[model samples]
Target: MAATEATKAADDAYDVIVLGAGPTGENLADRAHAAGLSAVIVESELVGGECSYWACIPSKALLRPVTARSEARRVPGLSDAADVALDSSAVLAHRDAFAAYWKDDGQVRWLDSVGIDLVRGQARLAGPRRVVVDGGRVLSARHAVAVCTGSRAVLPNIPGLAQARPWTSRDATSAKKVPGRLVVVGGGVVGVEMATAWRALGASVTLLVRGDGLLPRMEPFAGHLVAESLAEAGVFLRTGVEVREVRREAPGGPVTVVLDSPPGPGGPGGTPSDEIIADELLIATGRAPRTEDLGLETVGLTPGSWLDVDDSCRVKGVTGGWLYGVGDVNHRALLTHQGKYQARIAGAAIAARARGVPILESDRWGAHTATADTLAVPQVVFSDPEAASVGLTAAAAERTGHRIRVVDQDLAAVAGASLYADGYRGRARMVVDLDREVLLGATFVGPGVGELLHSATVAVAGEVPIERLWHAVPAFPTISEVWLRLLEAYRG
Candidate 1:
């Protein structure tokens, strides 16, 4: 049902219209269609969106081989074989394959197979329940219109940064040739992941952090362990430093990055430090929601601002509940998986409302509510020592006025962890709501801990009591046994 030239010229309508055909948008369309709604989705670029080509898939493809090699090196008998350099050409080719060679044909086919219409153009709200494509093609929605346009990487306003053509998350993940020297600005997920990827690919990476350490939002020790692993991997980390200026003589020339260093205790004001010259520079500072040019002004909504939404993903301040915002545009959880979760909830809500079904239970874990976004949003960072967390950290729980107890466990004490790799080092923490006797949050830092995050997510989201969690025994001789150890620590 792609919009051919004939279909593009004619006025089109559907029961539900979705803007931005990313994973979020795709799921929304699919769910709506499943619920007996005629759905159409519009996109300005590839249908699979950012995660399919730039952010997640390609990035993970680049990291898997590096992680495998690192794991092999950690084993007692495989160190020598794993010491060989990575095949850059093969790695880049594999990444391209995972990115689907920058093609959207498969996605378009999926949409067609699902009986959803696809319009190949940028779309925006022309009025309530009305959407206008780039060439003035009008689309009217009978039930709802969902906005899933995601975010883009934000480059800092440093002088000459734009002109220098620095790489954003997209460029770094899709880069074919690894630079000799790479300067990574920021210590967030993108910064750390890209720094790790390029460093493993034989680049001399210098990571500059404006804050005290990496992953400032997670538990303190998660950042500490990640910083230790990055340092051990030979990445030169410079904390408490900000980029003041960027200069590049030509398009393909070397980049010069100037740094501003704040003075220490009992010292004077900030001073400019040594300039860093690099073959390329990457700005992984942050991301801004892509709501700037969506014709929000026509609907009396401010452009360039994140759309506020209710528990059902319905945009606030919009009349009639016809307009909905999901994914990054709504400023909920920004992870792709969370966005998909929101999409499912939003799509189900739209379907239920269309059928005049009463949605009574919209609270935590309800069928039509996005409750997990607040209490149990899980995230995994694919660094050398992977960092995974869900719900409130201990500090976050305390700040929210919760009477909580914290339990910490040394992962090295677990026999399964010791068997996984030689000299394994890791830690796990569980934050419990003391009054409720339920899990509030959990954080795990170490190799192969990403898979264990779901257990914590279920505990927090399900509000499972600690006494009951003890009965949910873990199998022995597996890293999952850390859960049992954590329970014992909490009891002691």
Candidate 2:
């Protein structure tokens, strides 16, 4: 237990103290300092956090080679050069380079340049605005403390799983050598993207999905298209299956798994597969917030639970608004970009409060509010034929009681898409508010669709009316022309 504030004096004090030096925390401290507040950031691991070292950076670095080579093959003149199989060793080396070789020196220097103090130790809330680091050093916050600890990947429950030594997102992204045979469990972005990347890198990959399709949360067709592409690329794709047991007799040897009977309509429960051997096993089922040991309990907030926050990213239920929750810890939006957006808003709010300046805007998304997270959040799954979506889905819009008109466009039919790839295959959808005549959401699944997401995000967030959208002409012979096609379909 930390000494009471009356007993021990603070070793150091700052106007703003941030926990976790991930992108979210970094942004928060930067914003706070820019507001003329002294700031210090605490981090126990690499300063860049998951997105920089594991989840987003290395994963995308691993996928980009596969995507570029795949696109090269689609072009007529480049097919011969791209026909050759990818060299796994080279790909792994490239991923290592992009992940900064798992070092945080560069990031630390960045913090120094930005004038934010860096403290290397695990931080925990003692009480109110006091924090204890490494169970000894004390830091005091004059105004606010932001928790940007982020989240970690979760492993599912299964018999003998502990002894089996499975890989998580970190292992999958930072793997030194490609396994000869890799088995992936789960069907979400991490599962599918890693499966695609490893399979392209010469691993005999098998994807086991408990659900009937992949990318279950998106439009049904997104899963169908990615599944088809995975199957065509030699990944043994299976759905409606669950892992029963995992067994690895010798450490560092091959892994063997047992599968339960298919849970489809035809097979309720009957048999179990005895042996499915693989070089490695990755469980990418889900993620849980990293608030488990942040001393949230000291502040009357439950440990190992997501922190509830208002639009300004300030924790609710606390007597005062001195505690803020940013990034994955808040559970507002899990995407790193969304977390960074929230940090900027929370930082400004903290600064205004410190100066006794009233926060004027509450819901208008002014300098102090994070309205975009709820209104125009964007995400991109860097799997083959990237799946990018912004704002609400068609189902979400309907559920929210918004009367909407749905627009669909076959991306392959778009002239620009046809010119981009010989056998271009993809789809685009937009959900428009019937009364407002503005976009509520948009989804695109195809090669190079990720580049088109910003426009959709701008349209959805800006709430540009349909009439104004018609005049925003798309450039000729570009995949962006699908915007015009979508507009035409909506009008008809």
Badly placed stretches (over 4 Å) of model 2 are 1-11, 263-274
Looking at model 1, how many pairs of residues clash? 0
lDDT string for model 2 (92-176, tens) is 8888888899998888888888778888889999999988888978899999999999999877789988889999999999988
lDDT of 2 at 355: 92
User: Which lDDT values do the candidates have, in the order given?
Assistant: 0.91, 0.89
lDDT of 1 at 343: 94
Candidate 1, residues 1-492, lDDT tens digits: the string is 543221644448789999999999999999999999998888999989999999999999999888888888889889899999999889999999999999988888888877888887888889889888885789999999999999999988899999999999999999989999999998989999999999999999999999889999899999999999999999999898878899999899999998877655211233446688999999999898999988888888999899999988999998898889999998889999999999999999999999999886535678899989988989999999889999999999999999999999999889999898888889999999999999999999989999999999999999999999999989889888999999998999
Best by TM-score: 1
Model 1 superposed RMSD (Cα): 2.1
Poorest lDDT segment (10 consecutive residues) of candidate 2: 1-10
RMSD vs true structure, all candidates: 2.1, 3.6
Off by over 4 Å in 1: 2-11, 263-272
